[model samples]
Target: MVHYADPSMKYKLSRLNLARTDYLFSRDAAEYATYILNTSPIKANEGRKAHLQLLTKCAAALRDILVFGQACTVHRNIKN
Candidate 1:
C-alpha cells in the first residue's frame, strides 16, 4: 500500500509487472511525453483528413511551446 501527502489522494497504487525508471522530471518526462504523444497510441476512429488535421495542430502547438518556452527562458536568464 502506498500513501500520498494528500490524505484523500492516498490509494493502493498498482504494482504491475512493468519496467521501472526514475521518472523524476528534470526534462525527461516532458520530452518523453511529447515524443510518445506524437505516436498517439490511441488509434482514433477519425477519418484520414480529420486525423491529419489533428496531428497538424498537435505538431504546431508542440513547436510553439518549444520555441516560445526557450525564448522565455533565455529572456529570464538575461534579466537575471
Candidate 2:
C-alpha cells in the first residue's frame, strides 16, 4: 500500500488510476511520474518497461505543453 507523510494531503485520480495525495499545486507531469515509479514493481520486468514507455509519453506531453505556452505568448505579443 502507498503511504504519505501528510495526513491531510489532497487526493486525486491520476491518469493511471492511482491515488495522488501529495503536492499543494496541480502538477500533471509530476503526478504521472510518481504513479509510474510507485507502480514499477508490480509486474517486475514488464511493469518497469511499461513505466519507461509511460515516461516517454509524459515527456512528450510536457514538451507539447511548453510549446503551446510559447505559441500563446508569441500570439499575445503580436496582437498588442
| lDDT, residue 7, candidate 1 | 66
lDDT of 2 by residue, 1-80 (tens): 77767654525324324433334335877888899888667643553454545767533444444443343343346666
Per-candidate Cα RMSD to the true structure, in Å, reads: 11.1, 14.9
- Per-residue alpha-carbon lDDT of model 1 for 1-80, expressed as tens digits? 56588764433232221223444443798898888867765555433234545767543444444443343333345666
Which is the leading candidate under lDDT?
2
Model 1 segments beyond 4 Å from truth? 1-24, 45-80
Question: lDDT value for candidate 1?
Answer: 0.52
Error of model 2, residue 2, in angstroms: 49
Q: For each candidate in the order shown, give its overall lDDT on alpha carbons.
A: 0.52, 0.54
